[model samples]
Target: MKRLLILPLLALSLIACEKDDDSTTNDPGNNGNSNPSALTNNMISVGTDSTSLNKYSAYVATDVNTNKTYFDIFIYKDDVLDRKQYMLLHLTEIPTASKTLNWQSGANAPGAIKADEFVIYPKVNDKRWFGVYSVSGYETTGTMQATVNNGKLTLSYEDIELADEFISVNVTERKKCSGKLTFLLSDLQGLTTTAQTLDLVAE
Candidate 1:
């Protein structure tokens, strides 16, 4: 019985030693080839009013009152699985004096005087999206999120957070700088996603 007990104890010790060896060999943190996945989408600016929207590189909006054109500016860049860059905007540059202004987030309209505007600091996860919305009380706000997918950067969001406000005049209009963007793999360079600098242009 003593011999049997000793045999089992020796086997247990050998197993423990093997486990420790395997743990050290498989340690990804200690491996020089291992890297933590981190990427960020940098937001430069968004076009809001007539002057800001006309020079946008993505899309164009038409002003009914002046029969002119406008463009919104949105620029973001990230390197996840691949190098991705995008710029999209809706061309609508009507003055805030011809239509009733109401903020719409997703499908619901949040009565607000104006949609909030802001920028998001670059971060990495998998995907990232940012946009402006009209919240309660004519309050405009912005939001951003990061998602992971096959180690790629493909994320987007465009549902407003409506604000509480009512239209008082026909000239009330609000231009929410909200849109979607995704980066493609062909834009990347190495195994690790690199940092990309995007330019901010207005139309």
Candidate 2:
């Protein structure tokens, strides 16, 4: 009788131990790091429009080595995302005298420009609204761009060129500007939908 009773007790103890192990493995919250397999790729956001042009801004950062760069997109009516970008370049790579490139209000093809009412502020404090002599112009190397949505503004060569670069925005205040609610990029690697409000203007 003693031997038989001991055998059952041992089996019950083994079952209890197995249950504990299974519980731990199924608890996803216990894992401190996010599971990479569940993440979306190349995530981006189409920002909300503001009442004042100076009130609208965004910043994007990417790793050139990773071949994943940030392209600033403008959101138009009817859920259309404009790919004609007002991009920020790393000015260090630009050569002297500047060159021409493409220019658009957003991330898609560009339309006509109301040249008289345009301004490009390289730094946030600079108050010089240069005219768009050429829609597609080049700038000095290593010059980054920031875009603002304040009606009409001038654009130059250094303002609209592409380089082998990547960017991330410092969105910390433009959260409640106006327009539509913020949405994250459903594509791209290691990106998120959690809204960030930063003011990074493009050249």
TM-score of each: 0.22, 0.17
> Number of the top candidate by lDDT?
1
Q: At residue 15, what lDDT does model 1 achieve?
A: 17
| Residue-level lDDT tens digits of model 1 in 1-203 | 00111121221122123211111111111101101122122232222211111111122323344444333223334221121233322212212221222322332211111232222211112112222223333333434222333433332333232111122121122223333333332222121111233322211
Clashes of each: 34, 68
Q: Candidate 2 — what's its lDDT?
A: 0.20
Candidate 2: tens digits of C-alpha lDDT, residues 1-203: 00111121221122123211111111111102212223221111112211212111222333234434332222222211221222211111111222322222221111121112111212111111111222333221222121212321112222121111111121111111001112222211112222122221322
The segments of candidate 2 whose C-alpha lies over 4 angstroms from its true place after superposition are 1-52, 61-67, 73-99, 103-203
Question: By TM-score, how accurate is candidate 1?
Answer: 0.22
The per-residue C-alpha lDDT of model 1 at residue 35 equals 13
